[model samples]
Target: MDLVGNLYLPEDFDANKKYKAIVGASPFPQVKEQVLGTYGPEMAKRGFVFLAFDYLGMGDSPALAGEFKQSRYMFRLIENTWDAVSYLGTLPYVEEIYGLGVCQGGSIIASAAVTDHRIKKLATVSGMMAADPFQWTDKDVAHQMIAAANISAQKIYETGEPDYVAPFGLNDDQSKEEFVSAAAYPAMAGESYDYYGRDGFRGPKAVENFSNMHIGDQAMQSLFSLCEHYADKIVQPTLVVYGQDAPTAICSTAFIDRLTNDPEVSAFGGFSHVDFYYKPEAVEKSADTVAAFFNK
Candidate 1:
């Protein structure tokens, strides 16, 4: 299969010798430059060949406005990710494949591993696997996504272009809100959004496609459905990392708890989901845990 974005092979790469491989996926709307660019090279220095790529709709890949919809993008993420793994396995030096996912990409990797047996081990940073976003239990929040989807879709249908408001969480007026939204993180300050509100980063084309597309509902529905369908099938050795100070720590912990509590799944060792994303100490600790798990 044709692979997209970048693939970095270790300096010692040789067909005669086999080495462990690590595959990294970034957060949504975030290109490989944001996280993987920093982490991949470091892991490569550790004697592991690292591979990172942009999702179909983000970064160097094809734009979403013309060929893809939000729902299809989610499915494509899984397919493309699996493609990366398949490509890695074909390398002469690759002996085993490990997955590393960040934020939304974390959940994507988890969902992929559930169905693809090629993934031997898993690690997630700030991963979300809840029924919905942290506040979804509230009817207001549920309706908010539905309403936004409807509004965006209508706008796209009426006009050929999208209005292109900020993505979701980091609106221009975010400072004016009563509380700091989760989208305020420095890494996401310029490229994030809340599905319900208008305070994030989005390109004009994304905005137009979002409004014109029906995939929003399909993506949300898949997220919820996958938690029930694949959570039990994730039997590989797993490590989950999150930041205590990070806004999504609670949700990450809840997800880890659900995965570790199941008898069919608990056999895999687990980590505290809150200590892996941004906390300095937590990041180091989680990295150690991941190194140990992958080495095993």
Candidate 2:
């Protein structure tokens, strides 16, 4: 869909010679900058062209109404990503595209790589390959999320209208002061606002055609169901980096165990899910791991 992208070319890049390239996928609610910006340039410094793009309906890309079946939604996401990878292929100097995904982006690239041979290698940082409601300390919330999405999906099926709900946003009746106190993951929610809310870390991108705050129920359902059916299909060499302290660390465990290909897993000390994408030490370590893996 003519997605917007920033291609970080290696220093002294030659147009005639084929070079390995990496496609960087953004974490949920983030534009290319939130996570990809943190590592894309660094990877380029390590001598590879890095391409980071906004998905369709995100950043500066064309917008689609946010309502569809889970599989269809995921299919669109996969196609849009391959669109970026395909663009890389069009470049005369590009060869052997690799994928680097952060958080949910990690899940996405993993799904995409299942059949897309173009992705010769893959790496994910704190990627959520699967969700188990029982894993959360507050299992009720986990079940609530699934129930809520299914309820919304039922509404869509009956009414033929999208249920516009901010999965994490406080309801209109809820007080902003209660954001931190009542939030499921108070710290993550607060940081999310800081990074993407008005005048926040990535507010500029948030303001520009980036409407990830509200997701359709079907989309949420699809996201929840991701990797349950296809994770093992990833045969390409893969690397998964997780934060030892991250809440979502368990999500990657299943992928590592189930991935038929021997997936390399690394855990960085003193890092949380957010830290893996934002903290300098974690980002550097993961990026180095990714560069080394790709170069191999």
Candidate 3:
């Protein structure tokens, strides 16, 4: 689909020189301008080229033919990663290519890397690699999520218009002030909301095409994107990083345990899963750690 992307080059980018490159897979429903935006420059500053793109149906990339933007079907996202790796190979200056995934992006890259050895190494920051949370953890919630996805899909078929909802069980109508003042961030009581509703840090005011809603059918797609089921098959050197106190840390910890390789882990204190997205300290430390791992 000729996916849209933003490639961040090192300050002294030289066409004649071969440099290691990193292809970043972003969290679910996020464009290249969000988490990738925060880390791309940092990776570039560290002497690497970073490629961040919108998955086929998300962000600025063209949606699947006849499908809606933000459809974000899981299988297509993996194919998009493979296509991104192909794009990196086209650059004569790119030496080694690596994969970096944030949140669900981690799962996406790993699922892609299973057969695409073109990606030499792998790294995941606050990755939600395990599927149990969304698939088997609670049968009732899983059934409920599946039901909602079915209804959303049928609505589109019946009305020929996309249905958007706050996937994280957020009130799509709430004001930004209301979200900022919120005492607790109930991390997706349902499945997802658009790219913004989770944290006040990056909301509608922060970027274009920003919204608290996404296609309601995404809940069904996430079930097929998990990586832990095949983590043992991955032989590439891997580095896993996450906020120690983050509720979702289990996603990373459990994933690393399933890896066949003796993967490295960097558990930083005082940062949550979302902190690595843009918080100064979290980004600084996490990026440095990821850069070091890729450099090694």
Best by lDDT: 3
Candidate 3: lDDT over CA atoms? Answer: 0.83
Provide the overall lDDT of each model, using Cα atoms, as 2-decimal numbers. Answer: 0.59, 0.73, 0.83
- Across 1-296, the per-residue lDDT of candidate 3 in tens digits comes to 58999999999799999999999998866788888998999999999999999887777888866688767878888999999999999999999999999999999999999889999999999998875763567888888989999999899989988898777645545654554455355443211222365444555556666555789888888866457889999989999999888888888888877898899999999887788888789999999999899988
Candidate with better lDDT, 1 vs 3: 3
lDDT of 3 at 47: 95
- Which digits, one per residue and each the tens of the lDDT, describe model 1 over residues 140-219? 86677667666755665666554344334333334424223344454333223222123322322323322312233332
Kindly give the stretch of ten consecutive residues in candidate 3 with the minimal lDDT sum: 186-195
Q: Kindly list the per-residue Cα lDDT of model 2 for residues 1-296, writing each as its tens digit.
A: 37788889888888887889999876766677667887788888899999988776566665665443112255566788888888988888887899998877887888888888889999988887665432345767666776887787788778876566755574323333465577777787776555555545445443454444444563454445455357777789999888877767777776777788888888887888777776678778888988998999
The residue ranges of model 2 lying beyond 4 angstroms of the native Cα positions read: 65-72, 133-143, 150-163, 170-178, 204-212, 218-220
Candidate 3's C-alpha runs over 4 A off are 171-173, 176-199
Clash counts for the predictions, in order:
16, 0, 4
Lowest summed lDDT over 10 consecutive residues: which window, candidate 2? 65-74
**Which ten residues in a row are the worst by lDDT in model 1?**
261-270
Q: What is the lDDT of candidate 2?
A: 0.73
Q: Give the TM-score of candidate 2.
A: 0.83
